[model samples]
Target: MPPQPSRRTFLQLTGVSAASVALGVSAPASADATPARPIPDGAFALGVASGDPRPDGFVLWTRLAPTPLATDGHGGMPSADVPVQYEVAEDSGFRRVVRRGLAIATPDLAHAVHPEVRGLQPGREYFYRFRVGNQLSPTGRTKTLPATGDSFSFATASCQAWYHGYFPAHRDIARRTPDAVFFLGDYIYEYGINAGDNLWREGVTVGPEHAVEIETLEQYRLRYGLFKSDPDLQAAHAAAPWFLVWDDHEVQNNYGAANSLYGVPPELFVHRRAVAYRAYYENLPFALDSLPDGPDGRIYRRYDVGSLARVHLLDTRQYRDPLPVDEADRLSEQRTIMGAEQERWLYDGLRGSRTPWNLVAGGVVLTAITDDRTEQWDGYPANRRRVLEAMGDAGTAVMLTGDIHRHVASELKLDFADPASRTVGVELVCSSIGSNGDGVDTDQYAKDWLQHPYVKLYNARRGYVHTTLTRSELTAEFVTFPYIQADANAQPNVVARFRTPAVDPRLEAL
Candidate 1:
């Protein structure tokens, strides 16, 4: 694959001239100054979102999906390009307008718009909205990371299968309004809906459009539409910016690199992956640099949130070796989860990081759970050790992860078998937003897994983790809901809290 384009290169290719787009303009012209068609009634049905925040600005996103569930995957948009106008303001009422621009919603991209807005003040809140003729999108709140600050906060969540339960966790996350949300994969499941599996939500069922597995580009786009149509999930996206990475479920379960779980050939799997990846990019608030190149994209990038923290978002599913079938294969020294390039990048970043808290966010768990080697860091022990050793008493290192559908707190040791091995860092695994139905507080798997001394706490429920990072310490809360399969009104509460002191990589219950 060729190297991805830089931000300026992408803008030039897309006809989005950064110089022409001005700030502090109350009203901007249409994309080409052409009279757009009459605005459709609910063009912003999927709602508005922002992501990939920088110190100076962030990306704003919206899709013209008047009918999100349309079978053709066009989202009820015209076959031609539609000009959409957007504005950024310092307040909710749009009185203090700052940045304004226009971006075309093309039919080829499912009428999606990603405006890479810049030239804004750092460490301050800004509100943004989109417009087309008389239609206006919901106002969304976003902020740039402080250039230098003493603190920051974020939430980690993943694995939200719409058919399993309601999105009460997302609703609560929206209410908390964290600075950013790290969505660690399983954004949308690839399985076809089954009535037998719809035992949760009473009187709720998947529509005909979602009754088949997603494979083609159109199908993947429609699947994303189905998930994004959820009111609770839409609210979460609108409330705060998100940083995303994908896992197997985004294409198919257990897919690694070019491998698929159903024994499909590598050549065929690549096509499916390309389509899924394209749809994923079109639906999120990702910067142009993250645009897909065939079956590959560059997602492993560093986000420096001032002097307080540095978040290294990783892409584990795209470059990892296939699942090991036997113990010898699992223990092979050549096995890698982050590929060679990403591994080198991560090591260099960790070694040269200047922030007080260094956060490595990925899609799967890092701590060893048991002898069973399946799909997490346990399957690639050699590479995991390399990463853990690179920290080497640097500033505080923390691993934020999702997947496994359970909340986990554990100590990251250089060697799991060696009890004397030093604790290099800590790993906090957030539970699913709504997967595996309404889960119990504890399960047989949790009982068997807690036998490991490094494993600290386990809660099997539907929720996310909220974290607060400061110069001195990092605090994390495992927030959970009583039930979500049947109760859309379920509320979230903190079930456990842990604190890790700076320079001391140990989890202490609070």
Candidate 2:
């Protein structure tokens, strides 16, 4: 067998201290000038992170602190700029360095820094590292999509509640090693845990010490810091760069426009939403194009992963009007979840897409959801129908959504009026990473909507979906784990596999 990676390599990979630290150390600074602060000294404390890769470039990210500490209420760090340097190598041994840069973590953005690096060769795996002074961060790995390729496979995942369980499924996701990971909303819920909450049999401790609803930027930062501390989550981020979108829990559960059922005033809700969005921007490895405008910001954008795909990342919450809850006779056409401009953008991209596939990254469950009480696509039939019509017009489209803590797959038909008719495209919804399972009734709820026969499989298992893509076909495998509270050695098996070949509408079981 080949020799194992050296302790130095392991330290580099795990973001542990490296030999370079000794060489970089300097004498203690004087108290009159800049006061010295303790640097992070362990592995993946703030969690490894990566995101949004173009054919020639990608974004790498991380926050300071061996712990997930953030700025105070004023968003000002009490310390000086943290010198964060990053190196990306084509070889795991880091034999050949492709890119290197320095990022300053400031208190204004909660010390979170995202360095957007470009000029990387397409369709390659690269390892990266962040270093401050002599202390090293966990080594993270990411890959670019194949440019002008026949096919590439990827997966969609979302909504992880730290207290709900474990992230065993994430281990399996790392093994599959897709070019990119698509995260659709609810990355971290702001909800307080309470005993006997039916949504979860038991609650896990999350957020800051105060268990109150997050409102200010400090509260939002605290919430994010709390989640970043999870080892499993940190490992997953280290494995690959993620394409992300937000859902309700990131701000408030079931919040739309200025309306919310949680009894928070609309103005207050908007205020909190702004804080949440800023914190999100601070935490993720996003392009500068994602910077917030004022407090209320837009999260919709598009990215291309080589020539393999063009992804449309949308913000369904910020622009949408209040979800309509009218009787059949009082239907209004003005209300929309995607709003007008965003919908137009999506349709135009779909119609104009030159790539082999068009992937939509958005929050909330968008497929065959039948609850009128919930504000999913199913609740707004007119909008859902319009999207389906557009999908039919847009050739070779595949949608991936997350919100529901379960796995579901189906071939979308232009007109669900006839289930056996032409298959317009396909959709795969992955389950939560460590979030609580939607009670035992999840299966029944899924099956009750069989009238929309486009649905192929709906499972309540807590796991993830893996997809492989080529120019001619796209194959997705739903990998389900036994339980979250399991060991890292645990592997999720291929619970179900489905494929959609190019030019063919029907999805076939593999």
Candidate 3:
């Protein structure tokens, strides 16, 4: 059995798993690590990825899967270790190889390899690939954060439900190939998937294990295999280094810490989170340092875009308080979404940041809509209050969030009820990548956001937000897709664009 997550404070990370006590641990190769047979056919069927960028290095990842949808959920591999070779080059072609090394793919991690590449020049483009026996994986492109720069552009994406629709939004993201990608949450839905033909996902077959909700370690590994097989998603992963943070759907919907929405005992739910978190680490291009120890993982961290900007990736699901049941509960000082320690860390970082732009990326919105306050920050008004006031002092802060399946661009206020309250920052809510099927321009929930003065625009569509920040101002483009299920190949269009100047938290039509 894999390590499970704990609902206790982040400091409780040391008791169970050895990885919990340290920053990172390498997968050990036992004496029986060598494969008993020759490498299988079509070994690299699941594609490759690179992420968690740094000044000198990035993490490279790939998994061996001859039968990607095997019922046993081991990617059809024997219980042994495989030697996977990796190559990094200055050009797309492997002719100018810069670095080469070997990584051990262990059965404990479903034959996945996460080799951290280092000693590379900053602000320079590089291409990488993996090789196993006679097979070679697709080439992936990424760059390191510069030691100094004047501008940076990145894309924010979230909520990709395979059964909901095709991934044209992901295809578009691959085409743009932003500086880096911030994937907020819902990488894969935990619900059971149907093998029928009428679903939005056409022409794909799922294994029998997918007919029910996933719970075990192998089940979660198989679920990731199904989602990672998409070519468009693979392209997006290969396009740039991605930074990821999970929301409810990664384990279960509407779960707060270990408090299951359907009333499962906390002790039992932790078992499910153990496998889910382990599978999440095995599939994504996450560095070994942030590997989950049971149900507790450290993902809330910061990234500095040289001298241009600063980015903060928040983890809300792992350490949040239980949902409030009434008005007084919502207003209680004890209520919090970011946990106490993370909140203090965020405020301290904001106060000490010297960059012109401070970007905060989380899974939920800070802006309050008239309806639906249970899961988002509106449910915990006390935490929301501190974040609002802190951003107001940060001078040039922007909030990037996703969860609601609608694109919302709003100006945030300290006191939303008062007409003359101070403007703290701007919130750009990115819509789903392929969730909720083909969305619409307006729906019943649309009115709840439109009547608010702070909301500048609301479009119910499936797409992402493209942002560019420079010394003078930050520009935003809300990209949307016309139809996802009906026309999987449809080209995307920019529905709205806005700009906010440095040190001034106000949006102007671009």
- At residue 1, candidate 1 shows an lDDT of 38
Report the backbone clash tally of model 1.
1
Per-residue accuracy of model 3 over 1-510 as CA lDDT, tens digit each: 223443453224322333321212233343233344678887888988888888788898888998888878889887766777789999998789988877767676788888888899888788999877777888999988877767788899999988778889889989998888999899988888875533577655566678788887778899898888788899999999999999988899888888889877887787677667878988998887787766777889998888777788898888888888778888898889999999999999888888887889999988977534778998888898888888877758789999998999998888888858988779999999989888898888877898888899898999999998888888999999988876569789899999988865688988
Q: If both were scored by TM-score, which would come out higher, candidate 2 or candidate 3?
A: 3
Top candidate on TM-score is 1
| Best candidate according to lDDT | 1
Error of 2 at 90 (Å): 1.6
lDDT of 2 by residue, 165-252 (tens): 6666666677667777888888777766554451242334333453566666777777787766667777778888788888888888
Question: Once superposed on the true structure, which residue ranges of model 1 sit more than 4 Å away at CA?
Answer: 1-30, 33-35
Positional deviation of residue 88's Cα in model 1 after best superposition, in angstroms: 0.7
* Ranking of all candidate structures by their lDDT, best first: 1, 3, 2
* lDDT value for model 3: 0.82
State residue 146's C-alpha deviation in candidate 3, in Å: 1.7
TM-score of 3: 0.93
TM-score for each predicted model, relative to the true structure: 0.93, 0.86, 0.93
What are the C-alpha RMSDs, in order, of all predicted structures?
4.1, 9.9, 3.8
Q: In candidate 3, how many Å is residue 214 off?
A: 1.0
